[model samples]
Target chain A: MKSPLQYRILPLGDHALCIELGEIIDASINQQCIALFHQLKELAIPFIKDIIPAYASVTVVYDVAAIRKEHPSAYGFMKEKLEAMLLRIDTDQPLSHRKIEIPVCYDLSLGIDLQEMSQEKNIAVEEIIRIHTNKTYRVFMIGFLPGFAYMGSVDESIITARRAQPRTTVAAGSVGIAGEQTGIYPLDSPGGWNIIGQTPLKLFDAKRKQPVLLEAGDEIQFVAIDINEFNNYNLG
Target chain B: MSIQVIKQGIADSIQDNGRYGCQHLGINPNGVMDPVAAAAANLLVGNDLNEAVIEMHFPASVFLFKEQSMIAICGADLLAMINDVFVPVNTPIIIEKNCVLQFKKPLSGARAYLAVKGGFELQPWLGSFSTNTKAAAGGFEGRNLKKHDELNFRTVQKYGTALKNKDCEILNWKASVKNFYPASPVIRITRGSEFDWLTEDAKKRLQSDSFIISNQSDRMGYRMKGDALIIQNENQLISTGITKGTIQLLPDGQFIILMADHQTTGGYPKIAHVISADIPALAQMNAGEKIQFKLIEQQEAEDLLFEQQQQLLQLQNAISFPLLKFKQQYAID
Candidate 1:
């Protein structure tokens, strides 16, 4: 049997705690973190507000008043409860990730930085798109903006650095790459990622039951589509 | 029944206790910057503590009440007026129909909160009426109130019947303004996860050196210019969930304090987290203001938060009892 991972639970403030599972970003470590997140969610601990699963850790936010109503001390009660729950998590269980396929239009008109990135990598734009779509990526975390999923470990051949000067505003649905990771800008905001393509799907909608289309453990695949198909895809 | 916006001011939006349980989906908890002031305003109007309120900056929004209603204005003295009559903060005032409420200038803090008796009839997104403008979600149409925009109230009928005879009347009891703000605020903080990463000199300077808030500061964060803090080793932290009041040290050695509309996660080294009790004071800080940080124990921070909550509860009970009795009398008759 594989040995269980060691973790540290540190106080973020009076209302939150950070559980660090590992120091490095690895698939196994991420799985462990996600498992703990699911277990905590299942426990349905009162006063727990948000459970955020990231690259290698999970942060639990709670209401101190609600916790204090049940226990003499809020942090003390939470620490003891979480420590007990941590020991019961079964890391061997298979994690079920929702698979999602995103269609992207790689036409030069939409991808403003394609030519620049191509020149830096000494590769054709078509080959870069092919390399990007060929592999399945894991959703490491969802952050920077609402519904902006940070997916990872892109193909080495297409890797490029972030823009020297970030654009004042990156349009929503713009897919971009930075360092070893790739992500989609769910909203129009200032960003530093190198744009490679554009998608027509709405990644985030507050009206929907699930506001964010992607989650931390979901698997994502990018498929190249023609410019005409991209234009026809209904965003509404 | 509704209020129309005559002119929108800088950064005006509807906010409440904030959207919770959704930060995991990368949505920011964009709420009122000053929760204490927001709650006080709500209490004065006989509304729930988490009810949505209009938050405004200097030269705030000018609104016209289409119907008579009871409302309360709290936080920062924006020199508010009703049809040219001076209005005070932290008190419930009944306004006549068609009366225009305007904020002339800023005499004190940077932000002010306005609460209506029945609370604004806004559609809640993700369990909150707070506006998250970046995503164009929540609050009044996911945007700031614009000219000619109408906002309805939930209990307009009750308010109209209660004060039909008065052109304007201020409530007898008012929220105590003494402890609302301090002349020279000293924020309390606790060491963050990466606090040990800083050099001894840098750690010393963090407490001793004074920092000035930069003009670039907004609801997203407050950037401070002070002595550059040096770390023993140049290390990068994995992007993790960051909460409001997290003090992050940038690669250039400067610091940025995350605020109400802060991003869900950040990669910079988190040097400290301002305690919950002091976040309200920090939020009221204006650009070019100087601030100092004082380190406190974790237990001390918790105790301070508990005490503040207790005080708010007492205030709520004191204000709500009379309102409840009046409603009972009206029902009996």
Candidate 2:
């Protein structure tokens, strides 16, 4: 109701407001959230600290001290500005979507659970790789860890449940599957997802111009690569 | 010259003001738990607010100073003792070379900040000196301090000339920050966006209930052991950005207050938010400690933060004059 733009701005603590575009995790709602994210970036509100685009929401973390100088209530000032921006933001406007190709080596050594997965699913390891590589997945959001992208809608036939006992340390670049969801570990941290393969491309590099390889809304498809190719990656 | 670490604490890591604007990429700004105490420590030693300081947990580290420098210990009142002389918390002290500074007991507080005059000689990662242990980057090899690890000082110069031949000398002026952090503090909170998601009875129970800080807690978040808050409707919450003091209602009905190293986004129903002004007090609270949340207006929360900031700035101004005189008298500047 704060912004007549079909968006519900929820108060997140004292410094942030979550602009809910929709309740369900729909693609169009997410797109509007992402579009609004880019628009807010272009607007470059000085008081805005971060514009975080989730599945169907954009939570804006603003500077309370800075905003208070301009208006009486920090939330009121930000809510009004967000409403004004949302009114003009074109969510349906053709948004730029990047379709990235990632190469993965589905070796048993790298993918610790591949052998067990193949045996349990009654499918050959090669066929399992084929099913994984054939489809493109949309990155719903980047969360849990730095550069860790949460992608969705895994093939129903190949959907796997997360391991009951999570590994204490999951290596970075390890591709894993959690029922209806697929993601890559961007850092060496504890994880529970069933490992299927390992990617040659770095999902996150802090030194690079763009730290995270994949962003929310990007379409990504896995490509089968040999161990030699995986080892030889980035040699050039 | 570097100060040699004699005994290592549980998780003595380097921290500063923290990294910001990188949460969208999923990187959390894991900095000092107590910003107010950390700032006071830095200001006492005449260092900038962003300068790297050692965040020491109870059973803290024993540092053998290889260089004579002015230092201040703040936050958790770990019994800071040097050469058998008790170095008081929130007071700047001049220590001579070879003096071993150790925390004897956890008198109060959970984490202590050790800030030197010119700060630690450390490199920043992603524009912050705060050690992100999860990523294994930044702050002294991207990990906590270990025994025999030598930490170098940024401004390597002759210091503590006023100490004149003493092992350790407590400076004249000290910070009065006890008012900000009291024993069994009633942390203030403001209504969250999803506050109405709870039943009217649950809403009243929120204020009436007193929660205990669970052992399963860290810099990321504090899990509270309290009454289960039943949601009025079982509505699925979409993941959205959460902040430092967000109080989210978990599936089992317990609350988890997001902290310094919290995730960029979460899907749990946020019931309330610990006001920014009281976060430092909450940060000092450890396991087994009781916490009571008092609901207040958002406007009042903002005013409290403003008041805290003004008080901190006032302390900085008060310390500067005596520090300048200390430097002048000691001929260390």
* Local distance difference test scores for all models: 0.87, 0.87
> Candidate 2 recovers what fraction of true contacts?
0.77
Assess chain B of each prediction and give its TM-score. 0.95, 0.97
lDDT of 1 at A204: 86
Worst 10 residues of 2 chain A by lDDT: A1-10
Query: Candidate 1: which stretches are off by over 4 Å?
Result: B158-166, B324-333
Q: For model 1, what is the error of residue A61's alpha carbon versus the real structure, in angstroms, after optimal superposition?
A: 0.6
Each candidate's fnat: 0.62, 0.77
B161-211: candidate 1 lDDT, tens digit per residue: 455466676766678755745567678889999999999999998988889
Q: What digit string (tens of lDDT, one per residue) describes model 2 on residues A128-215?
A: 8888988899888888899888887787878999999999999999999987789999988899998988997888876676777888
- Binned by DockQ into CAPRI classes (incorrect, acceptable, medium, high), candidate 1 is medium
lDDT (0-100) at residue A185 of candidate 2?
Answer: 98
DockQ of each: 0.75, 0.73
For residue B41, model 2's alpha carbon misses the true position, in angstroms, by 0.4
Task: Please report how far candidate 1 places residue A9 from its true position, in Å.
Answer: 0.7
Best by DockQ: 1
